[model samples]
Target: MRDNGAIAVFGATGQQGGAVVDALLARRARVRALVRTPESDRAQALAARGVELAAVRIDDPASTVAALEAVDAFYFMTPEADNLEEVEEEVRVGAALVDAAAAARVPHVVFNSVFGADRFTGVPHHDSKHRIEEHLKKSGLRATMVRPAAFMENFATVMAPSLEDGTIVVRMPLPDDVPLKMVSIKDIGRVAAALLLGTADVPGGAVEVVGDEPTGPRIAAAFGAHAGLPSRYEALPLSVLRNDLDEAMFRQFAESSESPADLAAVKAVEPDVLDLAGWIRSTGWTAPADRARS
Candidate 1:
């Protein structure tokens, strides 16, 4: 069993934070999940699982500081929004939490950052995390930033509807040979839990989390195989997506950055980290033939 300590988890209702809370609990760590609504069904579920609940305004750093007084460790994850301004606000709040943790003398901090954040300055969200990272480093806090690769859940997010209709539109402007580093959000939580529980440490002071690296067509094939649909990836220019802000950013990523993640290293830390195929099966997203017929 992992050592016991009170760990404050931000974004507890969301995917990443929820996974972290579950992982921490599995290792018998005391978890204090910060939620906007303690009455929320998800929050209630976490409480039922023996997770302590703390209400705090995630956008307010001062509030986080007050709530984190009882926690020995902190896991901070910025919530994503459709608006760029909201994202910027979250970044500021994340940095504040880091400073707050420092003041509180939290022993360890596990920050969920994006892969290529330190290297790619063009991606606004990625750069924001890097700025927070700089602040954490300057604070002299014992922190481990987990820079996760592109989420495999994203394929479902952008392509689910299109895949249901048969063709998976690949908006990424990358060649077939160029691999996209992808990891399951659950795997991200697993890695973070290991760090927080003292089960593992990033030798280089940071972890680039990746479960698998697959090309666009390969992702399409996996989805097709799981869904039992005759789906194919149709690589199109940014114009096809009508220059959507998110798609444009992804295009910039394809042009400027390379998705380099050490999957072997990640696997060594958490052997249960799911590969693409394993994730596909676990999610149970495969539509039955009868459902597809409709």
Candidate 2:
């Protein structure tokens, strides 16, 4: 069991924050989740699970400060929107939250940043997280910024329709040998909870989170195994992707395939972290018929 601490979880109703809250509860940590709607289904479920519900909008500084006043740590993640202005707004909100947490004298902050956030420039939403990380470091607060690689859950997003149609589309141009790291949301939560509950000695640290490093072919194989179809990854050119895809989405995917960072660092610390094969197996999906297509 991990030590209990009063941690304020932002975006608790969403994916990353929801995972964090679940992980915290599993370890018996005291969690205070900030939800905009206390009566919403997600919020009600969290309340039922013993998380303290604090009403606060991510953009409201006073509400954020009040929520952080009594918490020892914070788990921060902003929502992603379709527009650039919304992207900028997320950055502004993150900055505001950081300021409030610092003002409240919170000892630790855990930010869910994206892989290559420190260097990527084309995608505004993805890049905004890096700016927040910089602000947290300069604020003199003990911070652990986790830059997670592309999520395996992304397949569900892109291929959900294809799953219904029995087909899959490969949008971003990734070479057969280009390696990409994929992490599960569940593992992200587990690692994050461990970090929050552990000693707060390592400040100003940035950790890259990943479960598996797989190539396009490997990914196709995994998908095939899970979906029971002859799935194959077709390499689409960047020009074609740009014409058919959202600019921001295409840019984010394009840059991720080229990131050189190793994900073994996080697994080294958390040896029980789930791998891609284990993740697929856990989902209880059947393997495809033609493994050769992958």
Over 4 Å off, model 2: 1-4, 160-172, 199-204, 226-230, 239-261, 287-294
Each model's lDDT comes to 0.77, 0.74
Model 1 reaches what TM-score against the true structure?
Answer: 0.87
The window of 10 residues in a row where model 2 has the poorest summed lDDT is: 160-169
Per TM-score, the best of the predicted structures is: 1
Tens digit of lDDT per residue, candidate 1, span 196-227? 87788878778888888877788777776776
| Root-mean-square deviation per candidate | 3.1, 4.2
- Candidate 2, residues 1-294, lDDT tens digits: the string is 224558889888998888888988988889999888999999999999999999987667888788888677888887774667887888888898889999888888888887767665666767788788888889998888877777777765653213323543333466677776778898778777778776322333777888887777677767666665655677666665433224555556555667655655776556766777677777675543322254
